[model samples]
Target chain A: MKKLILALSTAAILSVASGAAQAATKVCFLYVGSKTDGGWTQAHDIGRQELENHFGDKVETVFLENVPEGPDAERAIERFARSGCELIFTTSFGFMEPTLKVAKKFPDVKFEHATGYKTEENVTSYNSRFYEGRYIQGKIAGMMSEAGVAGYIGSFPIPEVVQGINSFLLGAQSVNPDFAIKVVWVNSWFDAGKEADAAKALIDQGVDIITQHTDSTGPMQVASERGIKAFGQASDMIEAGPKTQLTAIVDTWGAYYIKRTQALMDGTWTTQSTWDGIVDGILQMAPYTNMPDDVKQAAMDTEAKIVSGELKPFTGPITKQDGTEWLKAGEVADDGTLLGLNFYIKGVDDQLPQ
Target chain B: MTLAEAILLTITTAATPLLLAAIGELVVERSGVLNLGVEGMIVMGAVVAFAAAQLTGSAYLGALFGMAAGCLFSLLFAFLTLTLVANQVATGLALTILGLGLSGMIGESFVGQRGVQLEEIAIPVLSSIPLIGNLLFNQDLIFYISIFSVFGVSWFLFKTRLGLQLRAIGDSHGSAHALGISVIKTRYLAVMFGGACAGLAGAQLSLVYTPQWVENMSAGRGWIALALVVFASWRPLRVLAGAYLFGAVTIGQLHAQALGFGIPSQFLSALPYLATIVVLVIISRNRRLTLMNTPASLGQSFVPDR
Candidate 1:
């Protein structure tokens, strides 16, 4: 009787699992921070939601939040792949190697790593052109800054972050030739305390405008408290600094998520390195707020020109830290060079960490 | 404020939390009880403080509630390690792990909400003075409590009879026990004090430090405070200097990076740890200094004799 009962329960479980598997594709995500971190991870989680919304009953989305980026990430990714997840997304740059390692084990499962460089047949690298929005922020900072100086709190000196610093200065320089920006790397992407201190340090040094590449609203709140203008990153931080936030670079990955998940469902999923930009709708700017009408109009004009392919943020008349010309006038920086950007452009008041 | 004054003020702000938590841990360690759960207690304090402040609209009330939560949380550790006669180190570690996980859940809804920051209280004449005035006199309530606690702790540990008894108990609980000091009772109070201080420190993090609750927002600061207790060799005065030094190095590196000093940021980011290693090595080299302040029975569980 006991053996018969056990057999029946096993068959029941197996049937339910198999039935559910056929009904919906299991898409899993690994987050480096909590889904409610109010910054980077939160933005990615929002994108994850788009898959469920767009695919509806065809897709069953699940995520493991606050997965540390190391061997732990490898375990989490492998666990998801083993559990019949057709696709997995590792949403952190540090999870690059881990994702690759796990992808090798699960040859059939597709993997997507955000802001990572390495890729394999099963693994793909995907990120948005966040620097495009930084350009608009710089332009607005140039027009609206009370000190003619802005502060940038960076999170590591990766090519992506360096690109943001360079693009912002370039945009600011376009409007105000004498504009200077200070860069402070908090090292880690999060840690609200360190981010706040970095912002305070810059403000004390006379920067009237503040921006951050780190995943926290700490800098924005600091700017708000100090009565200085600031820009938000990853998500709309108008809630964090309702009046102080001039605008924000909202990372809209939903469209890309929908497209990629749809490809997987359509059986056309090929490993592709995607670096979408403003025109691709992978990222966008939060509404320009707390800035003058002229600055807002100017920012919109720059965004329009970028979308129209008339203005490139990495265009010529730019110089490296050593005063070497990076781009000749009217020369737009190639995607390859920008993707591997390791040097800081001139007017940036911080040394590039190699 | 001038640049120097501003930097100094920032350093003071940075050091206050470390000072408070470390000082509290110092008392607990002095009573021969090692509670590794300082991180856990501090985080709970942070979450509770933020939640209270958000709900009550009073940062002070929030701070009080946070401190109480930290104190209450510490009692869990106290009951297990002190009363249950469980392994102190294991219990302490469990407390921390429990604190981190529990605070994350408690603070889940509070995430993304801007917290009510504890406003600075400027002393009239003192705040008006040049340089040091604004740096020291004009600060948040937490800063005042932290600075005052260091002095109060220093006096309590050295100048008072109960302080000496606590030290005696730390050095030789059995001997103090024979002499009629309630070993368990003293340790209990010491642990509670430690918990309260850690809680207050956490309150500082949410209310005065960053002004919001981030999950694990204590951010290993409680662990730093633990290291600081050892770094100071269990001395109250040294903890002050040590915490401020750590704070100074941390803020100084950021300033250097901001100023584009041509130094690599990875190297700048490691400055505080490097300074800590260097200071610790120097302090350890002085055997007499370490021997004088080291708690003899620290981490050893004591069962009171009937």
Candidate 2:
């Protein structure tokens, strides 16, 4: 009688599990840092929540935060695949190789990689054009700085950071040909103390304006304490430096995340590479604050022009670090050159790491 | 402030935490107990300090709480290695892993919150002096404590009777035990002191260093402090010099980049570590000095045989 009852209970549990499985799409995310990092990972996690809010019961979302970007990442991805995750999002540049490695093993599961270039049959690559907003920050820095020197704190000398540096300088040079920038590579993506020290070091060396490509509010807080102008990266960090933040470049991935998950649910998902910018609403500028009225107006004008295709930040007469011409007059930078950008522009004073 | 003055101030700020952590670990090793959990204790201190400060709105109370947390965390190591006689190296490593994971869990809610900055003490006439004024006079409480601790530790190690007993136990725990020195009790106190110092270093990071709490915010500084202890030959004064030298290299690299030096940042960022190794090589060449300073029984599990 006990065996018969146990068999009946097992059957009942299996039926309920199958019924729930048929009704929902299991989506998962692998984050390189903590969800409360207040920067890069937090921005991505916000997008994941938006997907849940949009689909509610039809979609089940789970995420593993602070997953290191190596063999551990591959393990996390494969675990998600084994647990019936129909789609997984690997949201970090270092996770590119790991995502590709796991995608090959789980041919049936779809994978989306943020800020990565590689793609497989099951893997799709997506990145927001953060350089677009960086250009606006450069313009603001150029117009407002008393010293005409902006200090840029970079995480690594990757193409992404290099692209932002070049875009910032080009934007600044357009307004003031003599605008100078000093770049400091902190060598890590998210150490608050190091980032703060880098900012202080820059400020001491006569940089009146501060900006960072690294994930943290350290530089912003330092800027606030020092009473210097700064721009935020990855997320709105005005709370960190309310009085000092000129503006922020916020990464909004909610629409993209929801759309991709919806596509998977509808069986229309396919491997693709997407590098969306301001026009696509992927990169957004926070409300212009802590700046003069005229400067704010100029920033808004530049934003509108970029959105309307009337202006391109990387257009024409650009020079490489070695004084070689990168783009002649009237020529806009192509996606290939921007994606693999390895050299600094002529005005940047620091050397790029090979 | 002049550019030179500003750079010096940054260097001082950078060096103090390393000095604090290294000095604390120096005492632990000098007691013949090598606690590898400096990194763990630091993070625990940082998180607890940040949380306590945020809750109480007093940075001092928060710092004390941080030191308490670190001391309590080290007691686990003391119990495992000193009482239960676990392998010192393995237990210390486990303590670090446990501390890191536990701190992250405890710090989850505290992330993104702005911390209260420790107020600096500006002396009247001293702060007004030119060039060296602000650099020397207008410093935070932790800076004064860190500098004072250096002298205090030096005196305790060389001049105090208890200090001699502690060092004696470190040199030969068995001999000290036969002499009725209570080896376990002395080592336990030494480990707790090390934990408190590591905790204070972490509080410096959260409350004074960046004025915020971020996960893993200690960011390998704990490991560097451990290296500093070895690099300084376990001496308090040498630890001060090594830490400041490291601090100078760190801030100096940024200055190099800001000046637009055409060197790769990877190479520049490696300067502090490279200097540490070079200094270590130089110091190790003097075998007698190193032998005199290093604890003979470091990293050994002490079984009382009672």
Q: What CAPRI-style quality would you assign to candidate 1?
A: high
Candidate 1 lDDT over residue span B1-306, tens digit each: 688887888888889889999999999999999999999999999999999999999999999999999899999999998899999999999999999999999988998888898988999999988778878888898999998999999999999999999999999999999999888888889998899999999999898878888888888898899999999999999999999999999999988888879898898888888888888999999899798889999999898766
DockQ for each model:
0.84, 0.79
Write one digit per residue (lDDT tens) for candidate 1, span A1-354: 999999999999999988977889889899988888888888889998987898898999999998987899889998999998998988888899988988988899999999887889989899889999999899998888778889999988888999999889988888898888899988888889999999999999989999999888899998999999999999998988999999999988889888888898899999888888899998999999987788889989999998997887898878887899989988899889988999988888777788
Model 1 clash pairs are none
* Model 2 TM-score on a 0 to 1 scale: 0.97
Error of 1 at A128 (Å): 0.7
Model 2: share of real contacts kept = 0.73
User: In model 2 chain B, where is the ten-residue run with the lowest total lDDT?
Assistant: B108-117
lDDT of 2 by residue, A219-305 (tens): 999998998989999899887887989999999998899999999988999999999989988879999999999999999999999
Task: Tell the DockQ for candidate 2.
Answer: 0.79
Stretches of model 1 off by over 4 angstroms after superposition: A1-17
How well does each candidate superpose onto the true structure, as a TM-score? 0.96, 0.97
